[model samples]
Target chain A: MTADLLQQTIWLAAVLFAIGFIGLMVRRNMLFMLLSLELMLNAAALLFICGGAVWGQADGQVMFIIVLTVAGAEVAVGLGLLIQLQRRCKSLDIDRLSKMGETE
Target chain B: MSSDSLLSLLPLICISVTIMILMLQIVLVPGDRLSYWLTVIGVVATLWATFFITPLLPQQATILLTVDAEARLFSQILVICTLLLLPFCHRIPTARGSSAEYLLLLLLTLLGALVLASASHMAALVIGVELISLSLVVMIAYPFAPQYSTALETGIKYLLLSGVASAVLLFGAGLTYIGLGALEFSAISQAFTDIDLMEQGLVLSGLMMVIAAIGFKLSLAPFHLWTADLYQGAPLLSATVLATLAKAAMALALFRFYLAADLAVLQVINLGIALLAILSMLTGNLLALFQRDLRRIMAGSSIAHFGYLMVLLVAISTLHSVEGAAQSRALLAWVIYLVTYLAATLAVFSVMLHIAPASEAFHQTQLKGLCQRHPLSGWVLLLAMLSLAGIPLTAGFIGKFYIFTEAVNGTLWGLLLTLIAASAIGLFYYLKVVLMLISPAEGAEADPVTGRWLTRLPIILIALFIVFVGIYPPSLIDLLSQL
Candidate 1:
């Protein structure tokens, strides 16, 4: 990739990351929050691939693969926990999950 | 890699092979007792191997890992902690029945921690962190009792937050790679020192993001919102793992990274870490003062403890180079501080788990007349509280004293003042718990269930070590200073 193209890619990844972070903050539902997390992770992966292509090295691409694997594992465990949360709290809203302080 | 290089990785390999074997045993035989004993033996063997492999002396196992003395020391500490924690895991009341999987997850977490302690490449760093947090997510929610519904909430919260932190860390690492065109720590350091050839903005922001992500994992101030909830919500044993192994691994990794980094961006990074340290100290202690539950108090206190440790990062920045006498002193102080913190934290949690393995919240009132009823646990908790408070003639005091002197030597007057003030504030709640433990109950309180000697042995040894180290600090100082 050309220098100009790599700069543009960086900007695109930055913007994508901002969107994901905002989505994470704004969303109240557990599933959407997890999706937002995936978005953020993908943006990071994009940055790695862009860097790899521009720098002419395999390490960035290797990191990209690793990031993808990490994101996949996170989602698998996340969805499992979310299902359990859904069953126990009877809701997927993060606001409804404030049962920490009350006496059992 | 040569055979010697593979041999240097004996500690990690031992743990990994043990985890695989435990997984197979769980699948086929499916017995908790057998699995538990198997894990204990595996961890003990790993601990022995870690010590045994030290003669090899700083071998690079691959491009990914550096099995140095620091790595070996932390690996030993983590493995020993796992061994100490296994009995409590077995003792923890799991209403969900058949908790053999918890042991498996714990070992995986240990493997992650060991990887982190030795990580010399970006890939190793990310993998280690993900392994630790993901397994922790499952372990946090392992006790599926309806009464502890917050366990699920804590798990979800930790999962989402930790996920964000990992992404942030990766994004930062990606940007860093773009600026420097390398993922190895040595290359990054070399490129960073040649500042004119680097993209300063890319490297700076990328490093800041990486530090912020680590701060979240460490639960420093402004990133510490989830700590109290996690402490209160998770099972006590898992919380102990979170407090000791997880924090120690991340902190040690950060410390090693700081050691490898040159002076190009040292000023900015040091300032950021110093700010984090101050905020964590003030906020952790101040927040703990109002907490009624023991776990929540520990949450606040742990944040503060890490804050105190962060000051050493600033001390490193003050040194002219990485190989100075001052730097060695700082490293010595750090290891001693971490060891004492681990011993004291494990002691406190051991007492908590022994006291109430089934309760959701360990309230202050629950500890009424603990000394009169259960002298051994009461004394251990009291000593732990005093050690945490940094009172003289306790292990915590020794750790604090070294940190105090390092801050003075570094001329960090502002941070030193904050450390002093925070410890004072910390002393209140710590003593409050101590007083409550020692004082007689207002009404009738049942006697504590003093479990078998096996359960009490860890606490007794920890308490004895606390006093032993406190009175004779030179032995530890001499040993660690050589590192």
Candidate 2:
């Protein structure tokens, strides 16, 4: 809650976000990419909560909750699409999912 | 915060409640016709109510939403666009009996656009964007047909990329909040005066991240990889929504963000947007040149249009602090250009949707001697292409002319010249489509479908609007300048 703690929390969040961004780039699998996205969102939420505690305002907390809900909905819809894609292509490899283009 | 402010949010509240009630009614007694009619009625009623709600002139609906006159005008545009396209939704052939859920998702997307258009705080902006993109994901894959495998693929691509982009935007917003200690635009503008942007590296980088995310959404070049693929894959009506509602909402939101921001690093932002505009125009036109598919062609041309809009943004920026005459005049030109682009998009897509409801793509070769088979549809398309090409006596020409003048007056010589050259290249591809429709095919087999008059009606009406506006644009331009 002190200024030092707040700066550290932000530094931690920034590091976490960098890791997620790296994971998203390095991973080719669809599921891991999505999880990386979640990691990034969580980092954002951490920053919001830390900022709210420091500023003594509820707006940041409210934003965190909304981001959480959005992440859930995105995952749900994402998994549904992935499942359908898996059924057709018989694999989860990103390279294998390129059948949407004109194959002829 | 005040009761009066809450009262001013009547239109947005109406849309939210309508979505909820529609959800409840569906669970109680589900019927597609009933749901569709309910949505139609809801959107119309909200559109009507938007006008009647007497604001405190321009009141803050809450800490997040601002009920300003510009917001009202933009809300009117979005609502009217939805109402115009609802008929297309009704006509879009979905599997099985119940597409009530489709109606729900569409309404939710509208709600998102409504929220986004009025967002004055970072939290509201984040929520509004997530709402729009999430709801749009469901709608994009709504067809769920075996052959529409591309639709599902596009859905997955959109989900992942859009999620990442939103996360990026949210992270930037969080950084901004930490730097400024408040989420409201007013707070940020106030902080801009006290804080030296050169010293506040965190705030500068945060603003950059936010702009990058917006550039991704706008599909400006270098960040526009997924546009052609998504446009090619999504269903026609959904594509129309993406091209018009989603693009317009994101553009206006970015416009408002810039409007509210009193940044010291103003040149960096302008240079960034201006460079993006130039890149989009060059890259978009070059990509469209050899493409034979209609959807991809439309997608590519839209990037060029995005570039043109970006030019106007620069014009607006230079004119922002000037007396009312120039600044408002720039905004009016931008809005009229948007309206014309919407007309061209709707007119083109209506015909395409009706002609190829189930087909994946409309090839250039497929339309050989289309004029002979269906004159109404043919002329509808011809007019669309002509307008899109900014040919004389069409809405696009006047729109482009106004924007070009704004650019010259603003002394954006580099951007202005780039626009002129890109538009010349644009005319090539646009004409290819028009010529494909008009030229008689050798040994051509007559096409079978003439389409319903109901389908032809929208095309004709929109095309007529294009011609009407082209000839008498001053009235509308005058009206927009008043905003």
Candidate 3:
């Protein structure tokens, strides 16, 4: 039963990570891109949880908490920057925000 | 932990206390002058501890950090670079009302770099990286003038891309943890010595993900799309930090991790790194040739230089068993390369900032007949360019010489040839900049660059130091060997 759970968890985490990565690449909107980033982070957290369960160790759980904290910090900063970016560009498109490269 | 371990972490503790004090100052007085002096005191204390105090204490501060020689050297470099960068903060065209926050964030970023340079566990690595990148987000966008809108775009792009890279790095760590059941560097190395096939597969894939993420941070080719833009758009202060402190810390962490891991069984990963090195060297130099902007040219140069540093990674894996001396020398070579690279890069950026104090978009043409106007700036820029191009009788040549010798000893003929060719290509652009400095103005003389003596002093001193090191390579090699 534990073996089956382990196998299922691995697949689930991979699928979630892939979905997040794909979402980030596919979506050009800043908000959705941030959501995808959070999803990717959660996938990693899920893997940490699975690892802790399998190994019967707390290191994985500790790592999971760290990952969560980091994600939170990223979101706080990302969203703050997003609001400012919105005010400046009047749009949330990554392509439109990239006016730096062409000027050179 | 024991008193000795805590003492060994004096540098980190000093920086943290400084950050807290700066924060409190912000709430109370909220003046840039007070905050700036406080930060300098804090960083100087950290530097003193790194130089005098930490050396007397034990090396292992905890499982999460180790104050070994490499960490000590890197921390010193990071702190000194931070100090050099602080002066530029006052010159930023931001509103005077809230300039204290910039000093606060600078200290925070320095603390992060100190943590990263000393990281010995995966958790510490994650924290260190996140701390640096997060602080940088605010620092990059701190300039409030409406004319600097590009800073906002740069900050957001960096945030999103850095977020993805961090998640990818964590995911890789998670996978590695599942395979090895360990987070500490020593424990992971121990596990790698005796692992099953299935676990090996998991570990290899995880390692690849981590490398990719690091490569992204270091801005290696194929992952270097954002680099030139960040350099061009960032406030000059943040750009200097990004180019020097952040890259050096990440590269040091990557090296320590590489050395700690039992990499004999990871030949494929070494090969992958070699491939990235070749691509970066070729692409970075080739792209830098036609760049009109000084910052963008530097962005390209950084990509190629770090690519050359990747050769050390390959040398370690291949040279470990045959001759241990070669492996150790490779480490020495890395230090020389990094020290010279940092010195030369700082000089280049400082001169650029000195010349174009108010503007971010520094065009190459602005340098026309610099020798006639500001002889000091022209000479420093010329020498710095020579050092960067690895010309003989300059510091950069000594560094490249060491790397090339190591490459030859490790039988990395292909990488050596690539290094040679790319460096030749690099010389073209570097010399072009130098030529512009001396060549007569085509149309009209550019505005005279004006700066206080405080900035001018560092530029001259750095140029002289570069020349001194170039002429006396033995002194540096001896210093590195002693360390």
> Which candidate has the highest lDDT of all?
1
Q: How many backbone clashes does candidate 2 have?
A: 0
Q: Lowest-scoring 10 consecutive residues by lDDT in candidate 3 chain B?
A: B88-97
> What is candidate 3's CAPRI-style docking category based on DockQ?
medium
> What is the C-alpha lDDT profile of model 1 across B1-483, one tens digit per residue?
889889999988999999999989988998878998899989998998998898896999889999998888878778878888777877344676677888889999999999998998888889999999999999887864444667777888899899999999999999998888888877776787665544777987888888899889899998999999899989777788899888888888777777765532468878888999999999999989999999999999999999999998788678645347887788888889988998899998999977666678899888877887778888899999999999999999999998999999888999999998998899899999998998986666665475666778788888988999899988767766657
* Per-residue lDDT of model 3, residues B20-129, tens digit only: 98899989887777777888789889999898764554477778998877788888888988878777666345654567787778888888888988888889899988
Among all windows of 10 consecutive residues in model 1 chain B, the one with the lowest summed lDDT is B257-266
Candidate with better lDDT, 1 vs 2? 1
Kindly report the docking quality category of candidate 1.
medium
Q: What local lDDT score does residue B382 receive in model 2, on the 0 to 100 scale?
A: 86
Which stretches of candidate 2 lie above 4 Å from their native place?
A1-7, A100-104, B54-56, B196-199, B263-265, B442-446
Indicate the residue-level lDDT of B1 in model 2: 77
lDDT of 2 at B158: 88
Q: What is the C-alpha RMSD of each candidate to the true structure, in Å?
A: 1.8, 2.1, 1.8
Model number with the top DockQ: 1
